[model samples]
Target: MTDALDRIRSIALLLPEVEERVSHGQPTFFVAGKQFAQFRDDHHGDGRVAVCVRTSGMDEQAMLLDAAPDTYSRPAYLGPSGWVAVNVAADDVDWALVEDRVARSWELAAPARLLEAGGR
Candidate 1:
């Protein structure tokens, strides 16, 4: 695994019921069998290492992309579904922000009981 993938795995696995599996040639994180996060490496020649996660909605996706175009983007194949991508390979990447987003994604996909347990 690359450093970016390692970092994502470390943070993503901390959430309750989070599982890592390879999906579409990328490392994907699932909560209660629902995909919450996916680490993409040069996806279809995009030349980026990113973690795609679920956003609250299209508004959130637009807000994030507008706020930080360098760090956030509309992920391919999943963008229409309200998933946004964070550029994890950028030199100015903010890992804390990534963690926060990943946690939110986990909460979005996790079951009600798992979420009620604090999702830690």
Candidate 2:
């Protein structure tokens, strides 16, 4: 929906230096021209978005899996590393969480200059 897209775009704007485009038939938010997060729509209960992010205090990937396994899963190959996939459509998506992860992903992918401009 346009509303969801708008929300995502708005979040992307928060990342000082990032690009937003359509990739893999979905809205993708990139950092340094690399994909960090994407939105997908599925008719089934399958995942409707892939949110890749970084963690510090604890393993972000594991955080999602342990906190919300039904809605989040380990990324295909990066699962062992620390990348988690969240199902935005699985439940009432917490936009705040989405915003946080997208911001974190952007932080990870964004360059230092860009991060500085984005106010970290």
Each prediction's Cα lDDT score? 0.91, 0.66
**What are the per-residue Cα lDDT tens digits for candidate 1 across 6-67?**
99999999888788999998899998899999999989999878999999999999999999
The residue-level lDDT of candidate 1 at 19 comes to 84
Cα deviation of 55, candidate 1, in Å: 0.4
Instruction: Write the residue-wise lDDT of candidate 2 on 1-120 in tens digits.
Output: 556667778887766667778775567777778677766554234545555444442465666688888667765544565766665654487888878877877777777777667545
Mind sharing the TM-score for model 1? 0.96
List the RMSD of every prediction in angstroms: 1.0, 3.4
Model 1, which residues run further than 4 Å from truth?
none
Poorest 10 consecutive residues of model 2 by lDDT?
41-50
Off by over 4 Å in 2: 43-59, 75-81, 117-120
Backbone clashes per model, in order? Answer: 0, 0
Tell me the TM-score of each prediction against the true structure.
0.96, 0.70
